[model samples]
Target: MSWIYLDNNATSKIDPAVLESMLPYLQESYGNASSVQHRMGREANQAIEVARQQVANKLSCRTNEIFFVSGATEGINMVLRGVAEAYRRKGQHIITCRTEHKAVLSTCAILEKRGVEITYLPVDEHGQIDLQLLEDSIRADTILVSIMAANNESGVIHPVDEIAALCRRKDVLYFCDATQYVGKQDLNLETTPIDILTFSAHKFHGPKGVGILYIRRKSKPIQIPALISGGKQEQGLRGGTLQVANIVGCGKALDIAKQQPHIRNYRDLLEREVLARIPQTFVHGSKAKRLDNTSFIAFRHIKSAELMTSLPDVALSTGSACASGLLDPSHVLKAMQVSDEDAFSSVRFSLSKFTEQSEISSAIDELVHTVEQIRTLSPVWKLFKDGLID
Candidate 1:
């Protein structure tokens, strides 16, 4: 049976146009971008530069500011670790939100072991951080404030512009992990006070294993020491040969995403239908600004894993793919003060531009059926129905 994929936040399918754009580099134009002494290498290097410009154009930043990395995970590690090491003399404090992706949180954990002080800001029930608390958290020793543009599980958008402005006033460098927000939203680095931004192409209909790190160049540029050292690529910031085909795919995918209409209409329709059809269901981050493609919902007394198993044709997730295998409640939900049982009952349905109205209808039917079936076996659900539990 065909699958109805609703996990775009985890990763999106590569667009056909992006695949076509990458074919030449993978086939005949497979030359090392660094080897400029030869014609083939020159062609490859030119392609890489063109792709870089494409990405830069989409982000509305200078081409020199973009650097290619393996993926967002590497980019996050590079920024957090590099800044911590390079500016060790300046300060050793880094502030980040508690609901951040494992990429940021895990890196911060490592930094903590190495004598770096990390302040994890809390989020409200709607999965938003307190702006005043954020500003108050800044200190003379705080060198960086890293926050995500959007939550991977809840899809709630953070007030990044306000956060950036606060960081600027405090003289703290700001880093935004835009992996889930980049292609879906407009973020012009030229106008924003963001010092460092990272995104992976796979999150936006591009191939996997390719990402971009935007380091703004200013009079007092944020210095980041090299995380990987080899052939002096990426201005000696990140090393290793460029993945030409993947980079080309990323550029084409980002260009397409920028041109496409926002998928909010589809997402809203899906959520409306699901909430109307499924009893005892509610949305996470409903009051906050969220991405147009994400819906994180919790069904009382229904385990998301069991629901997912019952609807094999519907490609949904309990939470972030990185932490899904751990069998623990979602860190994001826990941070928002969602109970452990409710967190386990929650599932994330992230749509893409390619999702159709028919698919949404079908997913809702399957989900409603699956949840009803699961609830039939749940004594907790029966007790709630009898008003035994509030």
Candidate 2:
């Protein structure tokens, strides 16, 4: 059985072109980037610099603005810890969302223990933050506002620019977790007034263990006590020997993402075909302005995990991969006010530029069969037939 990988949001497979670019670094130029005496070190440093430039080009920022970290999770931690430590005198409060990735939530939780107050802004039914509520949430004690550009599970895009503008006006720092949006959308730092941006390489077909953080040049940088401190790397913000090969791979992957076909048509095709075949299924999140490569759907009366387990050939998820172990309903849906029934029945299908229409058709066929089988055994459906489910 051929497996269909629809879980691009969890992590993308490394593109062949990126792998080829990384082979030289992994095999021949394994050297400490901080070492200045050796040729290997210089070569590694050069490769890393090139990668930095590529990332900068993609985000429309200068090379100096981009700092490499382990992954998006670390990047988010850096921004939060940095600001809370650096600007403690300025404020003791921050703003974020309940539906944010665990990385953001846990980091904030740590800060809260350290005496920082956080306001978790709520979302509308379509998983959109109320801009006015966000604006009101900003207090004189607010030091930062961290929000994701697109939700990992629902594929809902936030009004990041507007939020950034509010933060800018309030003289508070704005950070964006663009891990899921950067590769799929046209990101330009010039227009987006976010003070800091975080992204993971693996989300964009690059290797794991590599991520990026964009710190605006003009923004006042708060110094965070380093989490991994040893050497003077990442401009002393994150100190350690850099992973040169993964950086190179990330650059190549960004280039590929830039050149890949627009995902709108393919995503629409998948949505139309899948929904047409499975009429009882309901799409989650916004009907418009979502990530073009993602579609979240719920099969009536079917548990997401149960459906997923039945389709061995399809790769998918119930929500954020980090939250996969939890049996509880998705916090994202709850934040969006999704009903308990809808949350349990949902599955997230995220496509990539590499996904083919044939794969979508196959996925739809599998889903239809699975849902049919589940419905047959569903006591609720049986009750509905007997007019007892009302």
Candidate 3:
């Protein structure tokens, strides 16, 4: 069985063209971007600038706004930690959604230990944050409002444009983790008014270890000190020798992603078939605004672990790949107010542009069979069937 990978939210398959574009950088143009005094180094530096322009072009932001980072995790840390420290006198409060990626949540947790008050805005049943609640939550001491453009697990898209406008109106800085939205959605940072944004390359079929952090330059003056400061790299906001090849790959992948068709039809087919075929199934955040590539499905009385294990040829996820090992039902689902029983039974299937219609059908078949098999063997399912439990 040729393995079908539907976990694109975690990490997508690196595109062949992206790999080809970066090969020369890896094999031949192995010059330090910082060492631009020499010809090879200048060429490497030139490649980095070209990649920067590509990312800037996609975001509709200035080239100076984009800075390379290890990945979104590092970028997120830098923004949160830096803002918290640099703007401590301005305010000690931060507002963020309850369903943000662990990167943001965990950093907020650390900040809490250091006395930063964090307001975790709750989501309704459909995993959408109330704009009014967000607006009201902003305090005079609130220094930054952080929110994800698209959720990693449920694919629920928060109203980022509205959020950005609200922040601007309230005179607060806003940071958006656009990790899942960059390649899939149209993001115009120039007009968005978001003070900062970050996204990873691997989410868009780019190489791992390369990411971009975009900080708005002209109108909004926000100061975020460097967390990894050593050299004069990233305008002294971040310090590290650049990964030239990976950066090139990230740019190429992003350019490629823009041209690739949205496989929403395939995602819809998978969800539609699963709901029609499976008797007791639920799609979390189905009614909410969502990404076209992700479906978070719950099979009643069935553990996600068993279902995933039974289908070895298919690659799916119970939750974020970043939170893979722990038996905890997704924190995102928990925040969405999903019951313990339903949460444990849920699995996330994320598609990409490359996901074909044929693979969608096959995935649905496997999922239907697996859910049936698991339900048949489950004592809990038997009890539910016997009317012993609801």
Candidate 4:
């Protein structure tokens, strides 16, 4: 049986064009980007610079602002821990939301043990942070405000422009984890005043193990200490031999994603059909603006793990891939005040520009049938059918 993959937010399949662009570097051009003495090394270095330009063009920032890392995890670590150490004298307080990815939250947990004051702002029922609450959270010693551009699970977009403006007014540094929204949304740093932003290549159609961190230096010189110590690389912020082939693939992937048609219509069609055909199912974060390619739904009284097991051919997710192994419910859903039962029942279906209409239709049919079968075995569902539950 053919599988229908709808988990693009976890990681997307590399585009053919992107793979083609990376082939030369992987096969023959294996010179280390740090080696500056030899011609082959210079060529590798030039290729890396070119890739940096590509990412910079997409983000509408200077090439010097872009720093390549292993992926968003490293980029987040570099920003949070690096800034915590570098700016500790400036401030010890940081502000963020409860719905942040583990990369940000986990790092914040670590900082807290080291005497950093962290305020985890709560979200509304719609999975959106209150701008007023965010503004009020800033203090005299608040050094940074880190939030994701769009939620990985719910796909709900935060009001990043307003958040950036608030941070600017408070004279606080703003960091946006744009892993989900970078390729799907158009962001121009020339217009937006976000101080720091991060995105992973695999979240788009690029090869895995490559990410970009954009640090805007035009407004003010914001400096963070290097996370890794080694020979000079990534302007001394990150020290390692650049993954030349992956960086080349990332550049090509971003170029392709920017030119692809929007997938919002297809995603909407899938959501509509699923809600119409299935009972006791609701879409999470439905009240807020979300990524065009994502649809997060919850089936009442049904566990997503069991539902997914029933539909072997459909590739979906319970939540962020990084945290999926845990048996606990999604923290994102809990942040939105979803009941524990509803949270466990939730599943996220994220699309890509490459998803076809036929694939959507097939997945919908299979999901509806599988959900129905699961509900039949559910005691809670049976109770509801007998008018014992409201």
Candidate 5:
């Protein structure tokens, strides 16, 4: 039987159109963008610039503000480290939340080791941070506030607009990780008041290894030290040869994603049907704003790893792909104050533009059967049936 692929948040499949746009750069136009002396190099350079403009136009920012990087992780490291170095005299403190992706949290951990005061704000039961606490956490010595646009595991969207406004009022630089939010929806940076932003293309049907970092130079006039120093690539801030094919694919992916409708209806049907079919299933971020393509469901008395392993035909994840192989509860769920049992029982079903209704139906049927079959072998499930556990 053909397998159903729902692990889209982990990474999307390459769109055929994006691949077609990138072919020339990979084959015939394979030239060093840094070497503008030759025809091939000039062609490659022009393509890269066009991509920059496309990215900027989509985000409603100037083309010069767009900088290319390997991926979101490198961009996060660059922005966090560069800003800390550039504004050390201003302050050594940075603010972020506990529900952020591992990339942001891990980078903050390193900054803490370097004597930077990192304030990890707490989240509510729904994985949303308290804006009042964030405002209170900002001190005169705080240099920056780094937050993500959405949660990768739960599809919970942070109040980025309020966060940006808060940072602006506090006179602190704000860096937003838009990796999960971008391409999934429209974000006009022109009026958002964000100082810096980062996103990856692979999340939106583009090739991997290419991403963009937007720095506000016109309005707020933000600047940071260079983390990688060598050539003039990325305005001498990031030094390395750009991935020509991947860059082309990145722009095309963003262009395509902007035109596609949200897959929320499919996600809703899946969530509604699963809850009706299962014994005790809960949806995370159900009431809050979320990506239309994501559904995080917790099945009580069921271990997600065992469930996923049993359903080989369904490509789903129990947590972030980075740590889903482990048996530990997801850190995102833990931050939301979910019990250990619920956390381990949750599964993330992320869809994409390419996903079809049939796939959702099939996956849901398989999930219902698997959850029921697995619970039959569990003492915990029996106790729950007997009203022994809540």
Candidate 6:
């Protein structure tokens, strides 16, 4: 069976362009970016800077503002720990959502143990944060408010601009976890008022193990203690030898995405066509303001994992990559108050710039057949007056 990959959200396949960009760095140009005396080091540094420029241009920010880290998980840890430790003298409170990725939640859990109070904001049925509640949650001791731009599970784009503005007005720092949104959507950080934003390269067709944290120069640097110490790498925030090749590839991938300006329209067609053919299936997020390349849908009476297994030709996910191997209901879905059945039946079909219309059509056909097959065997369906089994 020819497999169709629809799980771009978990981690995307490296694009040919990105892979090509990394060849010299991975082989002949291999050198520690920190080495200042050797030509090899200089070459690696040059490549790293070029990649930084690529990411900066995509984000509409200064290259220096982009700090490279291990990946989105590491980036979130750096920001959360940095802010909590550095500004702990000023405030002891932090706010985040119940639907945040495990990285963020785990970091918060650690902070809570260290005496930092945290508020997990609730989400609506569509997995959107309540702006009014968010505002109300911020207090004199609230030092930071970290929220995701696009949900990894539901594909719901949060009202980040509004949240950013609110944080600005209240003198609280705002951080956006855009790991799932970057490269898939247009981001103008200059006008956005987001104090900091985090993205991972693997989410956008680049190599894994590289993530970027965009820190607004004007914003007060959250005086957090460093998580990784030694070498003073990554501006002393994250210390380690930088992966120059992966960083270079990440930049190339962003540049490739930038050239494809019609990603929104392309993804809209996939959602429209898929929903048209399967009416009982519905998208998870607010359709109008989501990442153009993502769709999280529920297949009525069918389990997402079983459906995925039935169609060996297609690859997709029930939720985020970090949570995919487990059998629990998605935390994002539970936060949105989705029933256990609906949560179990949901799958995330994330497309990419390279995804063709024919591929989506074939996947949809296979998906329909798989759902029918599963429904026929479901004991729940046997109880129905009309078993619409195919």
- Reference-based lDDT, each prediction: 0.91, 0.86, 0.91, 0.90, 0.89, 0.84
Error of 4 at 58 (Å): 1.1
- The backbone clash count of each candidate, in order, is 0, 0, 0, 0, 0, 3
Each prediction's TM-score versus the true structure = 0.98, 0.96, 0.98, 0.98, 0.97, 0.93
Question: What's the residue-level lDDT of 97 in candidate 3?
Answer: 89
Total backbone collisions, model 6: 3
- Candidate 5 on 185-274: residue-level lDDT in tens? 789998898889999999999999989898988554566777778888988888888898999999989987863454788898999999
What's the residue-level lDDT of 297 in candidate 4?
96
Give the per-residue lDDT of model 1 (tens digit) for 178-228.
999999888888778899999999999999999999999989877988888
Model 3 off-target regions past 4 Å?
Answer: 259-262
- Alpha carbon lDDT of residue 320, candidate 2? 92
User: What does candidate 2's lDDT look like per residue over 59-122, in tens digits?
Assistant: 8999998889999999888789888988889889999998899899989999999999999998
Instruction: Give the C-alpha lDDT of model 2.
Output: 0.86
Estimate, for each residue in 1-390, the C-alpha lDDT of model 3 and write its tens digit: 578999999999998999999999998999999998999899999999999999998889899899999999998999999999999998999999889999999999999999999999999989999999999999999999999999999999999999999999998899999999999988888788888999999998999999999999855467889888799998998888999999999989887676345487788888889999998898999999899898999988888888899999999998788899987778899989999999988999999878988888888888888788888888999999999998
- Per-residue lDDT tens digits for candidate 4, residues 292-369, read 988999988888899998988889999899997898889999999999999999999999878889999999889888
Which stretches in model 2 have alpha-carbon errors above 4 Å? 219-222, 259-262
Which residues of candidate 5, in runs, are more than 4 Å off?
218-221, 259-262
